[model samples]
Target: MAGHSKWANIQHRKGRQDEKRGKVWTRIIREITVAARQGGADVTANPRLRLAIDKAKAANMPADRIKYNVDKASGNLEGVNYEEIRYEGYGIGGAAIIVDTMTDNRVRTVAEVRHAFSKYGGNLGTEGSVAFQFKHCGQLVFAPGTSEDKVMEVALESGAEDVVSDDDGAIEVITSPTDFEAVKNALEAAGLVADMAEVTMRAENTIAIAGEDALRMQKLLDVIEDLDDVQNVYHNAELAE
Candidate 1:
């Protein structure tokens, strides 16, 4: 990840979200429903639900729409039941990938996922195949030129685990999943707003792939992400912007 700033990676993800803006609401609603159903509707008692709501707000989802989905999933109203699934695989150049999905039909979901992998220059692997290469945690990445000292001070005071400044000038604050909200709030209060903040499966290491290989790998990822049941896509490949 040397030449690529952490903020660059965040922008890549944001760019992908923008490209699929039409489906953003659909994805957020599914996430809200699933999080609520699994952990109950009380945001205070349910960290997962709270995170889902945070994403909804970031996507500009309406307050009433968010609450309706939460209540519906909590059984206060009617909603579709979803089951979470994780698919691991190798992309072009053996880049590791993990796809997180929530679906009512595992049959259709798996078929579509497997088909997408096969359609591209990749192969879906067994459970835990690429998962071992990732760590589930909360990550807050600041844009290049942000004040590293201030970010470090506020993040540490707010329960962040580590703060690192990339050679390229992006600052990253890592925290345990449960402590993410507090750290993010503290940093924002301190005027150190992050470019990206989320509970994510971050790659412990990276694989750099460029040229045609990079293009193919990105296509594989985009296809997997476009699936209706897919919630998130994580990969170790750092492609050129």
Candidate 2:
């Protein structure tokens, strides 16, 4: 994490997401289906499902499509059953990578993921091989030029675990997953809007990857992310901008 720029990283991620907009609905549907199947169809009672629905709305997905997927997954209608899987690996410069997938065919998912890593000179590691490098939590990032003092005061007072403010990086508020919504709501009420927020596998530290290694690393990440079953990818590479 020594040379990692959180703001640049977040912006880069958003740009990548825009390029993958064609597949956004597919991924959200899978997320919605799995969440509902595992935790009933009631969004009010199922936090996971609620978050999935929120993502769908953010993506401008139709309400009926979202509801149908929920009903289908909850057994009110027929649907494919999905199983969650996590794949750990190492990218360029020994940077740790973690992939989260929901799939009906584990064999196919694993093959595709492994092939991507091998193609890019990386290797798929054992489960937990790289998981220890990340912390599972919620993060809210405010853009630069925002008042850091106000953000710190409101975030910490509203259950955020920590607030990291820096001129060269994102003003990040970290929280326990359960405390995430409360802290976000508090920030909003205080007129502090986060540019990005999510529950994620945040890297504890990062490795600098520049020049050719950075290009290879980005290509590797893009390939893995474009896989049909992959929902999210986390890594510790601080790539050159």
Candidate 3:
């Protein structure tokens, strides 16, 4: 809509996805494989793997390719091992940033991540420097004009923690990470399709940035997001609309 909802960010992200389909697929594959390796290949029994598979499907990845990676990670075939890492930092306007990565080469990944931050007007901080500013949860955002009462009724009944409507008319439903899939399914069954839905590290507060600072911050986020080893980038900067 016209405000700072997850849907707005997702629309921006979707616009960027087409130009980086290959890179996006690469990241999704890594996520699927890692999830499978950590929690078996059965989607029904493995929530993380199920979520990864959903992402792969959303990206239009071939089912066979997805299955292959899952098998490889689950020991049916050979695969490269990966380790998950989190990097914290401060971006323009003193806003906090968190980068989540999964890589087979930790040294190379860290160097690349550090270089992006340093070159983009940001400072890479030590572990735990910025993570505390975020809360990890599931978020679903509906576009403006949706029925707030209906969303609230359905969401609360389905285990959502909160249903909030912004000034712009967008409605956001928040839920625990473990209840994400169930809530999403419930919403779908009730014919309430969300414009954006994901499990993410949400910032507790936002720092407004505008003019030159906003531009620099957007560039910093873009470069960091474009990094091959970077999986997810979370920040608390609310760029001027």
Candidate 4:
């Protein structure tokens, strides 16, 4: 869990840098559109939509853009009918990788993803090939000032599975999928604003890769994440300390 936390912190910091370049807004828009399409446009009623909106707000995305995307998705305003897709594979040093994407064309996304793997010294695998090594959990990250004990108490009372440390100035609360919204709301009510919250696939075990392999693994992640269709990239590469 400490390793997971550390990696999350790194990603969070990287995300802040990416935000300055406007890439984060693009990613958030895609995520919000998908969430709206799947769960309706009402943030109060759609938990996933609410999470997406929160992310947009955190990234300083314009309210008009957020509303426009939600409306476009829920109103089906004649655009790409984006679909959620997951790609499983191995990274440098045999570290398992899982990439989440939103694309209108599966064929193109698959080719692009596979090319990334191959070019980075790895190969793509079938649907369930590497997913079995991971577990799906709802993770909620708290702001730096949030009290750990208070957050933990709220999480536990709301049926959270675990609360752990993160390398970022935050804490992560893991909850069952069904309990995600409830737990998030509980923590928020207790004055803990979540830095990031999402249901993600987490690797059950990680493989330590060092030196050149570590650099290759990071490069593979960067390539995958740079893909326009990619939403999230998960892997079992033990993050270098």
Give the runs in model 1 whose Cα sits over 4 Å from its true position: 1-4
Once fitted onto the true fold, the runs of candidate 4 whose alpha carbons sit more than 4 angstroms away are: 1-21, 142-147, 165-170
C-alpha RMSD (angstroms) for model 4: 2.8
Give one digit per residue, the lDDT tens place, for model 2 in 102-159.
Answer: 9999999999999999999799999889999999999999987888889989999999
Better of 3 and 4 by lDDT: 3
Name the 10 consecutive residues with the lowest summed lDDT in model 1.
1-10
Worst 10 residues of 3 by lDDT: 1-10
* Over 4 Å off, model 2: 1-4, 167-169
Better candidate number, 2 or 4, judged by TM-score: 2
Q: Residue 87 CA error for candidate 3 (Å)?
A: 0.4
Clashes of each: 0, 1, 0, 0
What tens-digit string does per-residue lDDT give for candidate 4 at 145-172?
A: 6788888888998899998866555778
In candidate 3, what are the lDDT values of residues 79-142, reduced to their tens digit? 9999999999999978999999998899999999899889989999999999999989998888
At residue 83, give the lDDT of candidate 3. 93
How much is the lDDT of residue 150 in candidate 4?
89
Which regions in candidate 3 have their CA more than 4 angstroms from the true location? 1-7
Residue pairs with backbone overlap in model 3: none
lDDT of 4 at 15: 67
- lDDT comparing candidate 2 with the true structure: 0.89
